[model samples]
Target: MIFSVNSKVLEKVLSKVYPAVPTRTPMPILENFLFQIEEGKLTITATDMEITLRSAIFIDSTDNAEMVVPAKLLYDIVRSLGDTLIQFQIDIDNNKMQLSTDNGTYNIGYAASSDFPSIPNVNHDKKFSLSAKQLKKALDQTAFAVSKEAIRPAMMGLLFEFNIDGLRFVATDGHRLVRYSLLSEKSEIPEQYVVPERATSVLSKLL
Candidate 1:
């Protein structure tokens, strides 16, 4: 695999999804990010089996390939570099990568591409798109009140409620509670979803 991309833009995207990557996982492969290159676009993904985030960036490449590179090391290297083009050269046979730029060169050890976890395919038949501004507002307002009790799965997450009137985002920690409501154009389908606390946190940063 070979590609050239902007370090600053790549770092921004990785930082957004890195929080969802668990520091300690039962499977060593889970500690890496799956990088898939196709045509001139590069797709990067990070997940902890629950919340998965994928971001894409345009790059210059003639070959397409996929591999799992150490997440923390990749993030650190990009963040430490200046705003210059980063040249990535991958040795698939040995599962190693070399990054070079004006600043310096770095090498990272990676795992077999087949060992990475497959991203779940979500059937969007029941999916609905909500405004990012409104969703971020609601998440910021109510995230603090999510209960820490693991036994109460329902309370461990933020309750997203909607009705004919409007929508409400509510959360509580048994002692304190918070609710953020607002008017919306999408109307009249009464439904609710319990968004896990960890997912909510990532959503807040991503939005």
Candidate 2:
């Protein structure tokens, strides 16, 4: 398969999804990004078994392909490249990815795409949208308060409480607690859930 994309554009997109990659794990497959091209768009996904993040970039492709490439290596290489177009050639049978730019060409080996973990499809019975600025502010204010202790399931992560009054986020590590609340003009949910610390870290980057 062959495709060409701008170096700077791709690098910027890669950084956004890099947080979801597992830096250390027994499953080596989680260290790579699942690269897929379909319907004329290229998508890269990273997952640490708990949270999965996907980002996309427009590309020039004649054939659709999917593969798994070393996340750190790929990100490091592309991030240093200049604002120029880079052509990518993947040899699925041999398990390799070849990148060619105006200045030079680079070749890297990759793992079997089939070995990448399957990303789950979530169906939330309820849904709500929050602005990006608000999300960033909320996570930043309360993330530090999340409990590090794992003994208590409730204290292990951030607690989100929703009610007619408003929405609230609570986090505690047994010694201290933090609460951040947001007002909702329309009341739709009265729910509570503990978002894992790892997931909150990723969400913070996304915002």
Candidate 3:
């Protein structure tokens, strides 16, 4: 498969996904990004088991392919390059991916897409949207109080509670606690979810 995309554009997408790649893992496969190219779009995904981040961009490609490439290595290389066109050449038979630019050509080994874990499909039947500013503010207000202690697993993340009163963001670490609510809208169904601290931290930067 072959495809070409702008270096800066690819860098931006990588930045959003790379945070999900685990810094240290017994499963080395978790340290790579799942690259899926189909039709005219390129999708990049990374996950640390608990959190998954995926981003996509349109690209000019001659064929479709999927492979897992080292997240840190690929992101570092792309960010270091000056704004230029990057042509990607995938050699599936040899398990190698070649990236060529105006000044340099680089090659990186890749694993089969089958080796990468499948990303869970999120159900969107019950969904709501929040402006970036509002979401970021909530995260900033509560994230500091989230527990870092592993013994109390439930308190190690942020709580998202949805009810008729609106949505509430809660975090506590025994001594410190924070609750931020947005009562602009109401929901008939009351639901709650615990978002891991890693996910919240990464999401804050993206917002």
Candidate 4:
């Protein structure tokens, strides 16, 4: 299928998802972004198995198709194009995709979408909807006290506990245990969840 999309909009959405793509991965396809075209919308997704980033942009297209293209290569091609409309065509038989811009044309190889693992469908019925600022305050207060030691898995992360009175975050590394709490009128936490320090850092920045 062939389609045309605004290069600037594509780049902006890709930038948000690129942070989740890892430099090294067991499956080469994990380092790539999955592109799905349906009707007049283009869906781009990137993942490292644990975290998935997805965004949809409207484009001009005739048919629907999907492919897995290297994220880095796609980013480089889009960056090279200078504020011009880009025409993208995919040839499934040859496993090749072509990108055309005002300056020039480029072709790259891509893996079939079937080879890539399916993205997980997580069901979050009881989610806390907090503003970025409020979440930032909660994370900032406890992140500093999170354990740096990886020897013990449980001690290497921050603990999130919600109760009838409030929500609490705890972290320790054998030396010091720091706890931060915030009262909430609308919380019904059954149990506590432990989130890794690295994951906490990423979540903090993204929020």
Candidate 5:
């Protein structure tokens, strides 16, 4: 398969998802980015099993394909290329992928799409929107209070409580605790979810 995209644009998309790639992992596959191209859109995804990040951009491609490529190597290469058009050629037979720009061509080994873990589909039946400012403020107020101890996994995340009064963000280590409330449309049914600390950290940066 062959496709072309602007290096800077691809770099931006990769940056958005790179945080989810763990620095140290027992599973080597988690160190790579899952690249999926369908129709004319290219999607890049990375996950450390605990959290997943994905970003997409339109590109010039005549075929559909999926492969896993080394995340750090690819991102670093694209970032150094400056503004240029990059042509990608995937040699499935040899399990190799080549990236070519006006200045140079680079080759990196790739793995079959099946080797990458599948990303779970999230159910969006009930959803709400929060401005970046509001979300960032809430995270700033509560993230510090989350527990660092591994004994209790539940306290390592922030509690999201939705009720009649409003939505409350709560976090607690064994001693200190914080609760921040934001007034919004009241929900008839109260709900609670514990968002992992790693996920919250990455989300704050993105916002």
Candidate 6:
């Protein structure tokens, strides 16, 4: 199967998902991007098994095809190729992905797409929308005090509480406690959850 995409868009999508790709894996294919084309859209997914990332961008393809291409190599190739339309063709028999530009063509090792783990859908019925600035501030004021000791589940995660009044972020160790409260848009917010401290840090940076 063959398809084409905007190199920059592809690069951006890959960059967003690349963080989920593990640097060290027992199966080398785990380090690659699972590329799937269907219904004129191209989806790229990467996962370290704990967290998964999947991004979709429109492409000109009707036929369905899937393959795992070395993530780092694909990232490097597109980065070096500059801004240009990229052509991708997969040779299933040879287990290779051919990337083409006006100037050249390159081949990269491929693995069967069936080997990639399915990314779970994060279907949270309760989703909160908050300003990035407010979220960052809340995290900044609270993240440093988060306890690293795993024994205390409460301290190992950020305590997030919300209601019609506002939102609150709290973290505590036996010695100290830190909390940040923000007055947000008034609404019904019965949802409350403890986000792992590690995930809190990452989401904070992303915001």
* lDDT accuracy of residue 151 in candidate 4: 81
What would the per-residue lDDT of candidate 5 be over residues 1-207, giving only the tens digit for each residue? 888889889999999999999999999999999999999999999999999999999988868889999999999999999999999998989989999988999999999989999999998988876689998999998999999999989899999888888889999998998999997746666899999998899999999
Q: Could you give candidate 6's per-residue lDDT for residues 123-157 as a string of tens digits?
A: 89877788888888889898888889878777888
State residue 79's C-alpha deviation in candidate 2, in Å. Answer: 0.9
lDDT per model, in order? Answer: 0.86, 0.86, 0.93, 0.83, 0.92, 0.83
Count of clashes, each model: 0, 0, 0, 0, 0, 0
lDDT string, candidate 2, 1-207, tens digits: 888888989988898889988889999899999998887899999989888889998787757888899999999999888799999988888988899998899999988778998887888878867788887788899989887776877787888887788778889988888999897623477888899988998898777
- Which run of 10 residues does model 2 get worst, by summed lDDT? 183-192
Q: What TM-score goes with each of the models?
A: 0.91, 0.93, 0.96, 0.87, 0.96, 0.85
Candidate 1 TM-score to native: 0.91
Among residues 3 or more apart in sequence or in different chains, the pairs in candidate 3 whose N, CA or C atoms overlap within 3 Å are none
Q: What is the overall TM-score of model 2 with all chains considered together?
A: 0.93
Q: List candidate 2 stretches off by more than 4 Å.
A: none
Cα misplacement distance, residue 202 of candidate 3 (Å): 1.1
Winner of 1 and 5 under TM-score? 5
Query: Model 1 Cα displacement at 28 (Å)?
Result: 2.1
Cα miss at 143, model 1 (Å)? 1.5
Per-residue lDDT, model 3, residue 73, is 94
- Residue 134 in model 1: lDDT: 78
RMSD values for the candidates in order, in angstroms, are 1.8, 1.6, 1.1, 2.2, 1.2, 2.3
Better model by lDDT, 3 or 6? 3
lDDT per residue (tens digit) for residues 11-38 in model 1: 9889877887889889878888998888
- By TM-score, how accurate is candidate 5? 0.96
Given candidate 6, what's the lDDT at residue 152? 78
Q: Output the lDDT of residue 123, model 6.
A: 83
Q: Considering only N, C-alpha and C atoms within 3 Å, which residue pairs clash in candidate 2?
A: none
Q: What is the lDDT of candidate 2?
A: 0.86
